[model samples]
Target: MHLSDHDLRQFDDAYLQTLTSAQARALLGKALADLKAARERLGQNPSNSSRPPSTRLPWEGVGGQETPAGEPEVPAVSGDVAAVADTPGAAAEPEETADPRPRRQGSRRPLSGAPPGRRPGTPGHSRTQHLPVDAEQSHRPTCCAGCGQALTDAHASRAHNARYEIELIQPGVGATGLLLHQTKHTYYECACDCGHWTQAQPGRAQAEVEWTVALTEWHLAGPLLVAFICALSQRMRLSRARVREFLSDWLGLELSTATINQCLHEAGRAVAPVVEAELYAAVRNVELRYADETSWKEHGRLRWLWVFTCATATLFVVGKRSVEVVRQVLGETFNGWLMSDGFWAYRDLDQRLRCLAHLIRKAQALEDGLEPAAQRFGIEILTVIATVMAAVYDARGAPPPAGALRARHAPMLNALLNECLRQRDAPHEKTRALARELLNDWDTFWVVLDHPELPLTNNEAERALRHWVIARRIGMGTRTAQGTRAFAHLASVIETCRKRAVSPWPYLAEVVRQRRQGLQAPPLPSPAS
Candidate 1:
């Protein structure tokens, strides 16, 4: 919306001093009228206002802003601004937008092509011979299908022709702890006492890799290499029993579960330093970052698993929840924007975006069960927020060209803040807590208004922690400090690789390969790099 010519003349910083009393009164009155009209038209729907339709409150009805179709109007109080509900007969609706994407219709159902019964075709991978079986056994029509006649041992009396059949046996999921003896070759000795040496090797290992509760060394081939893959959970959640099961089923090697645990710890020790350096480096140079911590267990003692994520890399650490841990991850000086919940450790950032989504949740919670005044206050604050959000959304979420949003909406935001600040000292504990959060982080929350493009949420960091959360649920956390280190490095690599669209297994293989060879672990995955 552009200012009127009269208002523009009055709006000039130095020119405002020359305006006469009558002219100033006329201009101010017109501006108030325009502001009132704008306010009335607001909340017509989610398209024009930041207020999600879900928070419309007990005060809205069809095509309504704050009152039901026939209910008597109430003044909508958002701070000092009182918006009389749009009258029932007064038509108010957001301007319709033309979306190019096709609108979906009805509930989604599964495609109706294939029947539910078993398919007529063979199952997947039934024909492909991806892995070579170690040993092969063949029979020449061992028994006749029609007569059940036992075939002679191979060529009985040199039969002219014989029918032959072949089949391949491969390992699959089976009884846990089942051990399959690796196929071997029996070397034959010369009867003549001649000196001859021959041997068979399935593969070669550069170093000794074993299944241990703590990783002593990372082996580069066979189960040793894949053990890193399992420890890092590239293929599955890392549980010693599960790792043992996987090794037996996939590599056909029976391994003690304790060794699986050791491999896991070794993996952490192997790459922790390499991962730590890269993570520290990545966060400092990143454009935008998110930091969060979730409960973690180290040998059953509670520890914090922290994550610092950006668009390209994710760094995770397991340590105590203190200023030191934050410094350990992000250091004393970071140039990029930090988005986080109002955790004190992150408050040191010079540039930060406080998560508005958390405040919104608190508001929603207030509305859910708080006293009438608090509920109304929460809704009012939400309304002001929705106003700014709706305006930004209308702009296709482009960051406003400098000072535009602040100039237009900062007053409204301040008004909302004033109410929260007042409530911060209210008698009720929940009410006081909610209000205090807003008051303490007032400046941080409003920063989002200045850069509408910046997310008003720290969901990125929250989301990064989910990988560890699920793993924690399954494995119940790590047992040793090294185990925690391994978990953190593996998680960091896994998340970073995912962000870069680089699979973790191959990168992990390189890390395991290099670390075992007394070389530095591979750097974090970066597709562009």
Candidate 2:
């Protein structure tokens, strides 16, 4: 769709609403042409569009049947094409039956799929059964729970079902002291017997300083240690002072803030290497890596809290928002698709999917503003992208959009970009600034479509950063350099455990347990391990 210079000039915010009747006709003509072109180009879908996955309609695939991948079950048609084909005089573009591909559908499921919900040979894995049982009581129903029928002897006279019952133990602090005796033997050099004596390995133990490490003193067992850490961080979101008060009041134990700080420091030290290794392993080989950064205050200095995440792990780093930090996290050569916003640090990276949500939000700002030209541009951009996304949803995981449809959409996209470039020097600051920004990072807007696995948005990384953002806003950011490092490590471990479906408390408690006993910290948990 082409706009004449006169038509384009009418896009000026002040000129549009006051246009004469003749100018109105010209503008309408241009808009109609653009809209007509837009109707032909359909490639957007929730998978490829700026529209989020959460916004997907539940009825998308209502009438559709599940077909095996790469083999869409198309209904065979038995009818006439020649009549309509011949009647269309222009180019004889064929008229055919509706696309036989199954329509996209959505559903509400607590879990994504309907699995057996238990493994083979698994015995009674319900929630009540999962926790340790303290007591069990059996009671025959004296009266029906619903109808109040008297049936104290119903089981004796009629069909009855036996049900197992489990009662949970009450919540109470259990403190246990552990005495771990470590013994090492050293052998002397070989003599006439001709057997050489090997030296014993050195003990990793050190004096149990008051603040040696979290759970490092062995004064607390695994359950208590895990409970304490969970109370301090995840469950209660409590400060050290609060944790002290909680233990003092409930558990009848006194813990100083300094002691609590030492515990966290020790926990951080024990878990740092293991967590870092797992983070790298988890994110390194993933199909898509989402990266994001936000403001972090470290020792009263403004810094960046960066998060790199994949499906199986999340790694956090707090430091300067610089290329060096990205390099440190991602290494020099990453071949996987990296999804991120259009940050200058991410520029020139290979295999990157720019966050469409960021661009769409910018367009939304324009859509809401008063400038007619800018508003129209923003609205059209949103429409075209949403249209393309709808088409993508219908693709049902088919290969990328074909050349013909891509070609049709190409001009429409070019027109928008051209319009942006044309208005780069517009008197309207918003229009000019947006145009300049789009022009500056133009390539990122469309590069990911070639790789179906690359995400269209960096929402994963953004969501990963959200928890810390809330915490930081509440003045929970680190106050010391060491504390900052510890926080990043702990956050990384917590997030990675969640991603891997392992309980952080159990794994962390084990790490601390090993550390306190002069043993090495355990590796990341797996079934085989």
Candidate 3:
């Protein structure tokens, strides 16, 4: 049998896979390393391998002079002055001369009233100038009040002086403003054997004030970094090295690829504790909280980012997408309404408020190409439930009477529930059977109708997770588990601030500053505030 190149390659791949597990892993690791190295080299010298060689012209001649392509000729210069002199009315024309001395171009003569010995356009030569004021002339006040006598050094005894004042007048928008400051010093003089001398002890010098390392860290890790990484990795789709180059060029900061990775790791670690506390608080809220999960990666390993958001706070957790993680984060005994999609992991949670939006979508699919009666019935039930929810939501501060609303929608909801049960028992296909399994959680699905405050869907959590999803597409994934944790923490804090209508950058700056100063955490302003 003859094999093509593709077939041969496939056969080779199969043969390689048949090796011992350890050997296979080693081979795969080596291959991955090689690919990574190749990518790095390509990023460093993108155009080097593709450039063409340059060509040069050859010179050869009888007199060792360069020859023209087709023919060689003598160079000529015209002495046009004699031609013009022999012409009629030539003397009437203006005389011209080429001095050939290097003439200065673009030089401007100094303007009148220019500063002494200063050239035109020279630095500090033009525009309004500021004259220095002597300290004695500027600071001396023009007033005398001590015993209504002219004040002087002799009249004002330094021994009995209580304080000295210094007033600074600084330029403002239109005029100068006075800045009154005080300097208190005690006068002391000791009588020496030969002569008298005076000495004044100085106060302790205050330390220079500047941003702390922690504050610098917060600014570096906040939205600016998040936006940069997202734009480079996701939006621009650049490799890590390219991203680093762009960041360095634009931010005026030097960061190695490894250091960038490490900063992300450290940022994750810094926010983990706060994230855990916020997550607990969000889960413990009695009012309904929306929950959702989306795929993420850490060091190229498949992971998930779980979002749990209430009206007041939003929390993110990064881990394996499983029921265990959900239970671990939200706790097994979580009794308050848990609003989520039809994911089976959430089945174990009691009082689950299954997202009706998802259910309506499924029902719409089921009704397509169905018998008229079944389609009408499904549509009617969906409409009734939607109308009830709409009325509840529209009532705002005054929610519709739950008992009355339930009474009106109960019959249609019950009929829909019965239809779901019937379909589950006798599904048309394997896919339909899975749909039936989701329908089996019907009781939990309609629980949202009973409580107006409980959201009909996990849209809040999903919206909160959008930033992470975008970051994932950009940065690919976190390089480590700790980095993932830090991302979750920062994302949670940022989203929480957003939900509360507070600016995240300034808030994060303040939090880092106050925390370092051993100050209490300021209460986050309300959404209205």
Candidate 4:
């Protein structure tokens, strides 16, 4: 039932007194039905409706999740609650339950007493091809461990422990094919005058990385090999299996997926400190920053990927899409101007710019809605936003005094606010929602009107996430917390390097090399002037 603004507002005792008993009852019934419909719409999610994936709640796809198409949803009930609900007029207490339907083949419990990991008799893979050494180096003890006596190669023992390391070499000038270089390192024991023997061992990083592999010089694959794996996995967006195939086909390297994955993770862990100590710190000090988040997955569980970007640096984080995450990235004391969408997590920030593009899109949706009044309201708001943006564009060359644009557009804005206030409880849910949104954060919409330098959209942060978003689709996101951490830090470094107009691969290789040697990575290059 379509009602005029006056009719909607005058639903008081005086207005009802004019209606007959039957008419009042019918109106009440219709109001209840509308209320039910509104509540149902509020419950709509990505799986069942046209809502975006961002709108999905944390608990939606977890325990007692929504059932598949054609199957009726059976609200989960515990054994005790089920018994109580069986009685007349007893309401059942909803509880979390495992989804009864199998998600894929063999998703159900395996035969009792079956062991975990690879099944018995499964074909195993390992390194079989021997790499010929291209260079040989000896590492000999310089001093005696038993005393402070100095020793040299002349006192070295005849017996020595030798190991080989394989690395990727850049194609030389005019070279076309991928090349692999091998090096043999021989460690010799030294005999001191005191009869003490000492031998040098490979170095290990003092700083520990939380991953399956340790960052040490003793690895079979060298630093450049690790960096190349990262470029294939993170930059080139190749899956582990695909990277294996590429290496085998092009370079005749028979590395396993496990090795490639380990290299990628090690590289990611190596650069984690760089992002935290340098890039994230740089993002905090910037005058303006953009922030955004998208859905991600870790071990088949839903997660969020957050990005904070400025002109000079970009940082990425993967975790819960909560206010804490925003605080973790930007911190509570961040006074820089934050340009982002209307996510509630950012509402507390003192200096923030609401993405006008996001609001315009919402208004556009309202314009396409079934409600006629909502359509008109959408058109009017769009006009007001366009006018404000135009005023900012005009003052770009020579900005006017503070509050000039706001004062100029006061009449138009006040009219829009008045209309929104009137329609805050409109019959159409979308109209009511937009009205409430506008009324809640009214100041953010007009902030750019005063300071023409501020951006109207959060496109910078969104663009920074584009590459990873594509990678997420291709690789289906990371598989573990360590994997997620690696992906985020590596992505941050790569994007930041791009923003500074520097090649990330070589820098990443150097970082891996230094980190493995238990040394600090080289600093990221400064932005080009």
- Name the best candidate (by lDDT): 4
lDDT leaderboard ranking = 4, 2, 1, 3
Comparing candidate 2 with candidate 3, which one achieves the higher TM-score?
2
TM-score of 2: 0.59
lDDT of 3 by residue, 407-525 (tens): 76778777766666665654234224534755668677666556766677666776777766766766777776555665676677777778888766545444443443344444454
TM-score of each: 0.59, 0.59, 0.51, 0.79
lDDT of 4 by residue, 1-529 (tens): 3455666797888888999999988898777656655544544544334354554554467321456678665664665778887877667546747775444454654344555677778987657899788999888877889997888757848546888889888888988766799999887888888888887888777755366667888878888888788888888899999999998888888888888878888888789779889987888988999998899999889999999999999999899989999888887788879998778999989888888877776777666554568789989989999998999998898889888878999999999999999999997777798899898889988898888988988879877887888898778899889889888988899899999998898899889889888888889988777
lDDT of 1: 0.62
> Which scores greater on TM-score, model 3 or model 4?
4
Q: Write the per-residue lDDT of candidate 1 for residues 1-529, one digit (tens) a residue.
A: 3366664665775766788999778767766656644543453343233344444655666444455467787654663233334345335646757655444355235345556666778564322323333553232333434344444443232222221112112245773532233222222211111222222112122343332332222221233344444543533675677766766577555456654555555666666766767767887787788888878988779998888988888898888888898777777776878898877887777888887777776665555442577678768867876886687675554555787877888679778878877887885455788788777777788776666777777889877877567778677888777567667776777778778887776666566656654666666766645
lDDT digits (tens) for residues 1-529 of candidate 2? 5676675665766877798889879878767756643542232334333444443444344322234568655543323454554556746555856654543355223334445567778696322313233333333334433444444332333222222221112243684542222212221211112222222122244644433344334332232354355437543467778877876676544456675676677677767768667677677777778999988997678999999998778999899989998888887887777888777888757777777777777676666555578778778778866765554454446665555445656777788788877889986555677678778777666654334345667889988877777778665588887777777888888877777777677677677667765777788776222
As for candidate 1, its clashing pairs are 50-386, 51-386, 211-259, 212-259, 212-262, 213-261, 213-262, 214-262, 215-266, 268-486
* Number of residue pairs clashing in candidate 2, backbone atoms closer than 3 angstroms, sequence gap of 3 or more or interchain: 11
The reply for model 2, stretches above 4 Å from the true place, is 1-227, 400-405, 527-529
Q: Give me the displacement of residue 10 in model 4, in angstroms.
A: 36
Q: Considering summed lDDT, which 10 consecutive residues are worst modelled in model 4?
A: 43-52
Residue 56 displacement in candidate 1 (angstroms): 24
